[model samples]
Target: MNQSHTYDDVPYPDLCYAYTHPGRIAAIATLLGMQPTPVENCRVLELGCAGGGNLIPMAYGLPNSTFTGIDNSARQIEMAQQKATALGLDNITLQTMDIMEVAPDFGEFDYIIVHGIYAWVPPAVQDQLLAICQQNLAPQGVAYISYNTLPGWHMVLMVREMMQYHTRKVTDPRQRADLARTLINDLVQMIPESENSAYAAFLHTYADMRFDKLGGHTDWEDSALLHDELSEYNTPLYFHQFIEHAAQHGLQYLAEADFTQVMMHDLPENTQLRLQEMAHDTIELEQYLDFVRHQTFRRTLLCHESVDVDRTLRAERIRHLYISSRAVLLADNDGNEYFRTHDGSTFPAEHPLTTAALRYLSQISPRAVRFEPLLKQACARLNLAQPTPEDAHMLAINLLQAFTYSLQMAEMMTCSPDFTIEISERPLASPLARLQVQIAPLISNLRHEQVELDGLSRAVTPFLDGQHTLPMLVDELADMVAAGQLAPSKEHATPEQIRKQLDHDIRYALRWLSRAALLIG
Candidate 1:
């Protein structure tokens, strides 16, 4: 394979941000109710860890854990290493080695993450990846594997096919993207605008989309169209097929990362009812439905151990409240002036009754206040001094925007002194959720290791502060060993030998700490 073709050629930084944020991972872990053992002690390995964009953030976030990132591209590995060194992060190690070369020696890991690798690679490599996960995943380990799915991609594939035919002679990436866009645009213009013409409507909508200013990157279109149109193994498997394949490898589908996308909720009532009646097992039913939907793009999590995933409790009835800053008008009678919400999204100015509520909230804090107190405060600030039944209803609607933005308090009544807001926790039934569960065991085990290693690393840090020589540290360790604080090692150890030992011990300690999330490098 060409060196460039071996890895994702584009600098997909945004994709990295979207796929691997620590907050999302933490949220998923919390929803699963799985205790992370510690950050300083876990062992994490990432396959296709391109340029360390994803792994570096993780390593930095969880300093106590040990991270190992592998890539076949030497240039990417070198970039990852440079970033690690610049950041002074010692917990992560990057190697320019193929998966096949290191699979055996890699040993079992607590967490194995492979993003944007499975579907893009050849069958042999894909099989090798699965085999590695099967062989080296610890008993409680979870593997996060993302791949392109089907059904959703069917239309996208059609677009790709069209683009490929039009751009067959174009070799340059930018030119190919432009040519594809032009072809799509031309197709759109050919549709006639007429009532009761569904094809015409489709063409018009497609044309509008082609010219839409917000319609994302041209390069993205080129890359996706090229891959979808040309790739030999761009086959999409049903959920059942994927599950069966995983079963053969000693792994079980735990859950999805995004709970909302699970087909159970969105399927037609009749279809759902029929599926429930026909399918015998939970896995079977899910797989059957997935086939029905022709799911494209799977963010599946596989685990070595079976976990019961029914911890999510639904919010039966939520009463929301909101508080916002008073609108600042440029003129006394300005009709268009409004205040921005906490999320930087705008909110239009309301009537005097609503304006009064906002003004009182603004006086207290420019940032929006909670709903419960805002009503009473509005009453006091407006000189009504008492909240009416009518006022309460109006306040509820005014608070709708805040509730939608997730800025309201956890409990409906924000008046209580103890009231603290919490992001509504939903069930983890998506690919993201499944990934969290699958990795839960590994995270816990690694966290434990991280804590132990962190203590050791901290103890040694004082020695490396540059006051003492290598011989002095060795003497101190020897004395401590004699005192039963540490284990005895070689007597008459040279400075270089002692330094080597310290470095090795520190690296090992840091590795475990990185796993635990205590330190990120």
Candidate 2:
């Protein structure tokens, strides 16, 4: 099949990727002491934006930020156009165009995103993609590109070869996916685990990761298999090699899209010291880290070569940014309290002020709190008259240290605490989210985080239009139970008990929606 028609035959998965959000890209840029285009009023472009899953949510969130997307597959572009129209998004434009034919005079963008396209295209197209980024990017702009990386890709390529061999005679995309999945499962069962057999270990690991992704997304499985795993033009390169190509196009490495993966803070101190001594520069250190971690994939951020990127990150820089935390307060076996994130990273909360700030962020998490106000509140808790720069510096150091361990907390340039957290009499979710759940379980909330809906949440999503009060929502749940659409916990429950259970259930479901970034205001 032709590369352009690959998506036309079997569509690629249409879902928001959290890391590719311009909020995140800009935040990373700002942290490096580069002033990125504020996500709110910037020009954004996406190369190979399939169905606008990534761009549409961004357009929804940042109405002032103009968006343009191009995909070689007309079918995918049409899907994007249809959805963009349906959403009433006037700020975005979708076009069906090839990367090679892109004109330098076409325009400049503050942020350019090339996700899930780099490694799958032919080499000429790949070079053109990078060249376009350099040509079209605005001053101080950031570009995100994801690819299959080397040393790690060594093993993944083996599995890909095996799958391709199995499906060699297959022409239909759907049949190719079926064959690939079946082959992997068969190999999993056929391979025996042993200490010496590394292939068996890698195979089992691959199966587990693949199945984990395949769990609830049959659409994703087929799309990914055909376009990603079984594609003809998949290419993998080392980190340094990719940078060398980018350099020729006047683009340089900015950072990794994932904050946690870029740092060596998680490694043992001696190992970190040793690696630092052995490697010549930041790029070499990264290559060594990739080899050590056995990473199979990467989402790299790039910028114009003329831009100055400060590698030395200072704690004081976060004082002017927004802060959010999902840290859970827990106690140790000795009853000593500490903060832990969803990723299971524990950090000490030593200072009373820092502890207060963290607690506030945790209470209203996913809602970004301003640094100054947070510091004032923390000082107020300590009964201090006013917050000082000293207070900010202290807190920034603590938060920065914790953020390095894991992304339990984050610093962003664009998020605001504008939305109300309390469950109002009439709750409302974005029209986009409400529209999405009716079509599929996967939807992007206002924060651009992808949410997989549970049955109860899915039922409650459409009703969150500020039209239904809390009691009215409870009534809907009761109606669902009565109509047999929703199952009761106990078959023989009385009417009074069921009503009470539903009243509680509706509250819990809606509250979950609020926290999941699904409920807008």
Candidate 3:
């Protein structure tokens, strides 16, 4: 089937969003020791912001932050602008502009996010982006950039070569994707299926996976093939190269978003040991190790040269306590448990014992409790006198991983009230739930009073259209209030009273909107 083509120019926003690496933004923020600035007041810009799928979510997430998205494609810019208007998000501005045209009039921004543009764009445009970063990012601001990397994509290149050669005969993007799939499928069928042919089996297995995923969208197939085919620039660079590049424009690589990825802990022990033995400097080790490992992608955060990245104040800015979920099953051993995660998958508890702990967690719903309390309760429920130090540590790590994955996924998906937790508490429920309870009433009061709440409320209102978490709605609302757009209640509204009022207002708002056919169930 010829998938619908909405426009001639490839939509950058949708493509960018599809391949956006997980945890990149949060990692950049953490490395820069930056906090989430008020969306209503902060100036934010995204270069190569495709159709604004990624930018729109961020614009909606932080109403306190003002957003400007620039794209080379006029059609993509139009789509983004149209969506922004349809959503009534006035805080965002979308313009059709090239990176070469970026100027001072765009204004300095507290944060700049650029994805999928660095590798594909020309060297001159890349230089311009760096110039923009140097001239435009706030003193303490952060820039999030994701690019194609080497080593990991080398294998992918072989596949890409085959696809390109095959697709040269095919004109349609969907057809290209299909031909690519067919080529891989035929290769797989030609190979004998046997355990001895593990390498061949892997290729076929990967082919099957790609085939199953083909032809869903034009942006998806085209971008995937394009990125794969044109990835010499996309491969891993020495940390020094990136550092030097940024330095030319007065920016520096602060840190990586997937800290673990940078740590290279996933590599074989012997290889790591050898690399550690050979490498003398941290930068050299990082660069050489990544090359050896064939690392393909990197989410890096950069900051201006004038910033005191080494100061205690800067260190303090790093966010350590994060909210995550238990989404991976760490261990399957009878008494020992272990788990693994890649990108955005949640940590899942392995056994009934851990499952019970999760159950106890749910009962405490919506309150930020101490970790000790949660551990104590889990121990009691499991009939264990106390959790051993190792046991406690294991659980803590797993839970933290889950929360991090959840937060990243939420951010990437552009979902509301981005759920997170203050790790100091072992809350009865998820920290995300507690945040909602604390903020729901504040939102309701502002809405009822027709107060000009901060951008946050507006950011989160769509998600709150009443079916999801009340806490998320409250967080967004509280952000609006914090931005001074919404007024605090004149009447004394206790938390309970606020909840009651919020519930009533939400119900009424939904009913009225539904009755007017302004909202569809």
Candidate 4:
């Protein structure tokens, strides 16, 4: 059977910022008490992995883990193959295949990821997806599926429906998107400020949300609009509806990708009590909470029904994981009881030991520390006596819970990336990042964070083979500028002037790369 591939036109090749990493997925599964397959040497599969933007980073980071990505778009698969080849990664395979055509003979995988595909595909394909999850998942494997959820999506659906109607006759994705945007903006402009209709309110709210994304830069978001809003199919389900769908295939909800998303205490007291009273099971409780929060999207994890998922929060899990934090200490009248992050999330340090521990973690941020050593150091800093076995256990549990609850303040990981904080002489760049520069300026960092390199930075990254110093880099740039391969900031500049500018530019690019965590050393 032939399937129409829409992604070949407007490729959905964006990186899912970090949470999809097998390391993070396996860690969450471990916390739930399911003995998940180790990420180091696991068999991983990704469905609808357009151009390998998300899965390639995991493949690069975990070189021993074998990866297979299947996308319907041949163009996307070709791009992914080129990137893998350029990086000299032998552990990954990219194939252009439809999800419905996936066979059991393809073999089982430890981690199966289906992001941005569940709700957008046809209903028959959705069933086939779950069947694949049931048939191909290892005994203790995990499946991550992200989808558009309902209630909150009610408004989004209205907008998407309008966009689809407006672009009904347009075949070209880009032109359809442009027409839809113009129509929507025109409708909004026609509405008077004095008009207090629900339609007017919805238009303004949606407009604000769209334009405000990408830091109020609308140029890059048009593709997203084309793909999501004007795509052929988009069907969002209620939380319980999705759970029911999973149960049909012998898969049960393990937990959310982010622990804090499932935390009901974050809601208002009255709302929480009301939701608890109305719900009989965890799934129902989550569904009701989604209604309260108006959740439009969810990244949910699933495991076989036979696997026991421990819903209880266990502190013992923290001891085996590595910890890192970007939270910084703030001065206070009562001796710095608060730790804050760049995103403005604040964690109040109520306990003496917890307070001291976070300060230490903040100082050594982006570098992970084990629980035992971190605890010992924090206790020593506080001039506290050695904790009893019980006390030590309790402290570890509390810290882990706090970190999970406040992820913006701290992070815990099941695996660590091979990266360095020190900028060595003639520093070497991340080999994966250097390869990515050949394909696109947007590259994945060692931390799996997507970073967009500027023109100068992009040009310099390929030459950062740990063999070039500042002078050598300038010489190469001078030649390129003289040959017109590289554009000068000021046209008609002399080679000497260009060399001088290249010196400053190369240094700036290296510093930026270091800050972006793309430098290996």
Candidate 5:
């Protein structure tokens, strides 16, 4: 089957990737000393943008910015246009276009996204991807590309080989996926874990991971799985080979989109020194790291080869950026407090001012704070007179180290979107999120994070139009239960008890939504 027809037959998942957000792209670009176009007013283009799941939220967040998303699947483009029209979003354009026909003359973009496409396309189309970015990307633009990498894929390819062979005769996509999954689980069950056989261990681990992603149901990501692993054109390349290809097209690697994964902070001192000494350039360093980690997937950022990219992470670079922390402060047995980031890395809360700043970031999290004002507030909290230059450097370096470890976030630009943490008398959420719940439980929040709504929250989201007070919201839920549209938690309850529970649940859902950054003032 042809590529477009395959996608049209089984559409890819409609989901937003936070790391691919222009906000994050610009942030990492700025940290590397490149003058990337600020996301606030930049133009963005997403190739293979399935239904604009990633691009539409961007347009909504950056009202001043313009977006264009093209996919070969007309079905997905139609789906995208429908949602854009429903959202009344005028800044985004979705169209059906073949990858090979996308000429550089189409338009220049400040940021170009080719997510989940490079390795899956034919080699000719992959070369054209680089050609388009080289010719069409703005002078300071960043192009984001994602694909599977080598060494790590060796084992995964083994699994894929087996699955593909087992499902070769199955014509139906969902049935093929089910059969493939059965083969995997069956092998895992048939072979008991043994110290001598690594294959058995790998199968068990892989099966568990699949269960985690698709849940207990074998049919969850039926189309997603069919395209991801069972597709006819899945290819894995080495980081070095991919960069060599990019270099031929006049592009160079800036960094990985997920900076934390490539960091050398966690490496031992001698190991880091050895790797640095073995590699002649940044590209060589990255390739070596890939080999060391046996990396399976990569989300890479690229820029014009002519542009000078400063790889140093200077403290001053963060002075103008916005910072936020989603870490929880924990105390050890000795009462030595440390902050545990969302990803499970722990950093000491040693510096007084730095700790205060992180605490403030946590307090207002999902809401970012500017660097200067944040410093002032931290100093004020510490009851210090003016912050000395040393104090500034100290806080900056500590935060930078933690940021590299993925313990914190710094963004070059952020949008208000008229949302706040405060819950109002008649709470309201972002129109995009409110519209999202009507379709599915996994919705996009203001932060570009995917929020999975619970049953009560999903039921309550559509009603948060800023037109209903607490009593009115409770009445809406009460009426739904009375009309048999919603089921009460208790099988049988008195009317008074149901009313009380409804009031409590509505308030609880609103407060949770407020913290999730879904509420708009």
Candidate 6:
């Protein structure tokens, strides 16, 4: 029943995002007071690195840093290798290997990443995965592992069981997925709404989520359902259970990859105090919080147990890091003073210095600024004389706390990747993004963001060298359109209409690329 081949047949779109990058991972580790190896020259390993989508961008951004990716699927590995070769990226190596077979001789890495793999493998394999992290990770290394958490998985598991049972006789992966999806669709219609049964509520909630993911798209949904829901093994564990497993392998929890989850400050004071009483240690506290938050997924970072972890966050740590934020200032009549993030999370901007700092950070966003200069600039903007030592200290603490609790408000990183938001003359695009355009139109930007390109945009991408002027780039698009290779939005339009649309698209694409930080110049 060649189950593993299903993944190769319908490959996962393994794109990189900001949360998974080693730079972001190491920065979080640094904030927690673990002196991780600098991301610039770090050695990284990713298990189940499907198609190397996530690791490739990191290699491209940090040319000096080396990366190795291991996947069990030969086709996915081959695809990744070909893409790496095309980009002239000498820093990364991709291989076909199973997690159970990873050896100590693979050498140590400053950062190890295992995502979308741990909770889906068999128990023995899960143990081996942790062992590999413990043995192959550098003494001060941080490893990022994401898993299906308990309480949240409790609901998902029930739905998954129903899915598997409904399609038990189906052999074809796609058919099975289609049948399971159909089953869920039918159940949603047939099930009675009961306020008492958690199961009924789960079905309603899950149906909405399924529809949201499908987005009326069948092809992509079938593949996702096939791999994620119908995979042969999908085990989940409580937070404490996972911690215990890592402890057995001499690994300790450092922090979550997403910093906001760890910030207990956001919880109501009564809830916080009650939870504190219920939890005797960090592990217990996190497990209880999962119960409270109904957490279904987690991206946890771990380090070797021998290293001392300082859970207490000090404002002084902010000075050692570079900061970036996507927060924007909003108008308020009451002058309550706050900034709102893309996700609607708000941070109080009542403090004069922090508000000035946030405003400045938002202006240069998608680009990181050093902390001291950011603070200095904010102080200058406030029209204040040089901050007294105590004033500076308070500002640092306030800024750090605000950024930590409100992730959308600001982001701090140990280092920044080399890319710019400014559009350049000649306008060079990211070599990695250009390479990705060959595989799929949805490519990762320099900031580890995904941007989807239309036919015109993709056609213009390959020739986005600094040598090509805007006129030349437009001419290339015009050629592509004329040859029937690139299709505009409106089909059967007159040539004049096509030309007008192409001109608009060319300008929009370049500006989009520049804004996404895909412009290298």
Best by lDDT: 5
Query: On residues 342-461, what C-alpha lDDT tens digit does candidate 2 reach at each position?
Result: 777777877777888888888888788767888887787788887676767888888777666777655455555235566888999888888889875589877767788888888888
Candidate 1 runs further than 4 Å off? 1-14, 17-41, 191-233, 263-274, 288-294, 305-521
TM-score of every prediction relative to native = 0.54, 0.95, 0.61, 0.90, 0.95, 0.92
C-alpha lDDT (0 to 100) for residue 330 of candidate 3:
45
In model 5, which regions exceed 4 Å deviation? Answer: 1-5, 192-197, 214-220, 407-418
- Number of backbone collisions per candidate: 56, 0, 51, 0, 0, 0
Q: After superposition, how far is residue 242 of candidate 3 from its true place, in Å?
A: 3.4
lDDT of model 2 at position 126 = 88
Q: Could you give the candidate ranking by lDDT, starting with the highest? A: 5, 2, 6, 4, 3, 1
Give the Cα error of residue 136 in candidate 5, in Å.
1.1
In candidate 5 the C-alpha lDDT for residue 381 amounts to 92
- Tens digit of lDDT per residue, candidate 3, span 1-521? 22223323334215224222222353345433455343336777888787665676556545666888887678878877876776578888999877888887779887787776676656787788788888888777777777766666667667776766777655555566567777777776676764468756767766655543433334555545444442233344445676678889988766655544555445688988888898887667777877787677777777777765541223222223322222234455565643434453434556444454455544432222345565677788889997777777665554444343443211111111332222111112222112322332211110011112233233334453334555555555555555655554435666556545554554444333222212222
Worst 10 residues of 5 by lDDT: 409-418
Candidate lDDT values, in order: 0.53, 0.83, 0.54, 0.81, 0.84, 0.82
| Candidate 3 Cα outliers beyond 4 Å, as residue runs | 1-7, 12-41, 190-202, 205-219, 226-240, 267-272, 310-322, 327-521
C-alpha lDDT of residue 191 in model 5: 76
Please report the TM-score between candidate 1 and the true structure: 0.54
Which candidate would rank higher by TM-score, 2 or 3?
A: 2
Question: What local lDDT does model 4 show for residue 503?
Answer: 88
**Which residues of candidate 6, in runs, are more than 4 Å off?**
1-6, 193-201, 211-220, 383-385, 454-459, 478-505
